[model samples]
Target chain A: MKKTMTRFIPFFIMASFLVTGCNQNIKSTTTAAKPSVSTEAKKDQGPVYKGKVVGKSNKAKQISIEVGKDKDAKTVMVSFDDKTKGLEYAAAGEGAIIAYEMRDGVPFATVIKPKLATLPPGVTVITPTEVKTLIDSNKDFLLVDSRPGNRYSASHLPGAVSIPVCEMQELLQNLPKEKDKLLIFYCGGPT
Target chain B: MSTKSAGQAVKAGYKNIRVMLAGEPAWVKAGYPTYANYGWVCRGNIVLIDLRSAEKDAAARIPRSVSMPFADFADNYDEIPIKAPVVLYSDKDEETTAAMKILHDNGYKKVSLVEGNFLGWKRVGGSLEKGPVVTDVRWKRILAEGEVSVAEFERALADPKVATILDVRTKAEVASGKFPSSQHIPLDELCKDMDQFVCKIRDLQKDEKIYIHCTTGARAEMAYKELKKRDFNAFYLVAEVDCKGNDCSIEE
Candidate 1:
């Protein structure tokens, strides 16, 4: 019994060392393993934008990602404010897949976690200037404000219809029947 | 109850609608008085009009009033007397908006509508005259209740030195056009830089009231209240200013 007890002490010390290592998060990619959205959880998030880094305006806290191969590739300009999570470690060209919503024609990244792999979901990002120009021309386009209904009625860009992100799936019914027209969605900036 | 449509009519270039509940027959039976017969034909710089067909105008209308048919109003809107208070009536009280539009477009700032048409005028023991119908109802109410009336505004415009009309629409909206002599200021940018507004409105002229207006009156009202807070003698035109090409006017 004494020999058995003596041997168990060494095993106990080894197990504790492993546990301490895990608590410290000692790994190859050592920044931090933040809470990631699983496949089912991500279903409720806003649209995902996967693309290659085309431009980065660090001062403006903006990034332009190109999401198609060659000529088909479309560039999307994404903006982030102080409240944006996962932005600190998000470097350009790290194969980004951004989950975002637009507000007043500006693309705000709500969840910006890039996959470590190649091509993902790359959508066109409409700029506020472009939207304004379109509005001035009185062109046909769906300007969707993806915020809560109360927030929308309180104050939103003129002509923007309310459609919150949580119920984005239901938007399929409200979308214009004419597929040819432009459909754009926007949300609160980096809240 | 139906004022919403009146406001919308103003937006659509048909301004100043006054609704009458019953016709001239009802008024006469009730022994109500009228403008023509009761020595109430008001004398002032005012354009009284009958918004009826030419045939109807020929049959009966108020004395000293013009016949500008309601349906044809938009086409001949430019001919209204700019400096006069436009008064209007037709077979029904529903046509007041049409008369108001023509008056507004022709730069006649003041507008009033006849609650009783020609029939109502005659029924109210008014003269069964062959002309249009009008009323001093708006003026009386305006003075007493502090309501904004276009007729009052027209009279005010006669003395341009009295008020500085400020156009507070955005550049995009202003690009459509604005009050000819009004100072332009985009309302959204009001607080962004007020020094210029402060500078422009600083000096005093005799009764130099500031009147602000937008395409619609919402922003202008906001700006007016803000300006009023700063102690600048100011008011807002709670009227819809409509424009088609070069033809434009404030529908009240």
Candidate 2:
């Protein structure tokens, strides 16, 4: 019965997350578990925890990665220190791969790797200077500023039109009628 | 934002679309003119300078303006902080144009001009003050939160072991030039193969410090988030970088 309850611990934690939202403290009940899992089990040892981070604390040097999927998911609170690798990149709401070891029944993160967002395919990135060059050379392209209206009014690139991303559908008429014309858009640089 | 906007444009039947990821901040940082609306000139946080003669300034000047005569502008331009968002106005078009060039040449990142100058301000019934002005140009640059100081970045550049400089630019951009000691990892590749990247750099532990940079720091910032998410000590430089071979010049 103790082992069966241990298996269901994750489901309870995930249900709590759904109710409490993202901003809440989550604890792992695995604190009392003995250190029977070997650290060298990098392969099918099933020791590596791959999941999305649910919460973290910079001061406490700890992160909670949600392992398993949906109904079976549970938040695993992992503590780290100066010895922990890749601790700088751990953030909540992002996917991460963590390797850990249970010491004194506590899961201590030894390595934390992040899963980053990939840009959508079929898009090419340009620079400010390159856009300027196109403007100076009088290229046959429409330069669009995708920032909010207030920022555009404060200041914007030369010959660029104001087309806020939120209002793109409403301001579709502002774009050139030609479908094949070059359309270059920019906003306040990538955050 | 541009990427999302481009996606919308694509859906709207705009076939050829490209994204300038660096956007307006990068354009202003590259020493280009950004035209300020009349409302911005009246209420925005900016160093509004009357570039006309002292006689013109004392007779009728915009509020929150200092008299910096075009004739002696070269001498007084240095008084304005390089990072100050400067907006200039003068009766003569020639003077305003000349004053903008002077500031841009001197590394003033955010330089702009009031639409239509002083006459335009008055034409729109904008507020003005007369007689001897008391407000002198006063500005000091404060680095944005989390931005790496140029001096500290340079110090790290001089010593490779202290921090690994990660260039997050594309292959074409890197082909032109890069820092001698930077680890080459385009931001797109870093996003897809972060696990492989961590394994590849096994010599440097997860706590190893990495400084990320791109042509205009946009991609560097994006890459910074990725590295930080994985628990790597990372900092991104928010400056315009121009490189020719091994030689590179950074402007903030």
TM-scores, chain B, all models: 0.40, 0.52
Q: How accurate locally is residue A91 in candidate 2, as Cα lDDT from 0 to 100?
A: 60
Candidate 2 per-residue C-alpha lDDT over A81-173 given as tens digits, one digit per residue, 9 for 90 to 100: 789887654665545668888877667788765432112334444556677899899999988877787777777777778888778665588
Name the best candidate (by TM-score). 2
Docking quality of model 2: it rates as incorrect
Candidate 2 lDDT over residue span B1-252, tens digit each = 565677677678777776664456556656667788777777777788898888888888988888898999989898887767888989998888789889888877667888767887889898888999644886545555445677778888999877888887777778999998888876656755678987655377777788888876656665676677678898889788888999999987
DockQ of 2: 0.23
- In model 1 chain B, the worst 10-residue window by lDDT is B19-28
- Residue-wise lDDT of candidate 1 within A85-131, one digit each (tens)? 66643454334567778866677777765332100111122334445
Number of the top lDDT candidate: 2
lDDT (Cα, tens digit) per residue for candidate 1, span B1-252: 111211222233332222111112122222221122123234433456667787777777676667777788776655654544455567866566445544544555445444355676778765545533332222322221222456656555566676676777667666776556667766534533555676655464534677776665555655655565456677776666875544568675
TM-scores of the models, in the order given: 0.27, 0.46
Task: Assess each prediction's global lDDT (C-alpha) against the native.
Answer: 0.49, 0.69
> How would the docking of model 1 be graded?
incorrect
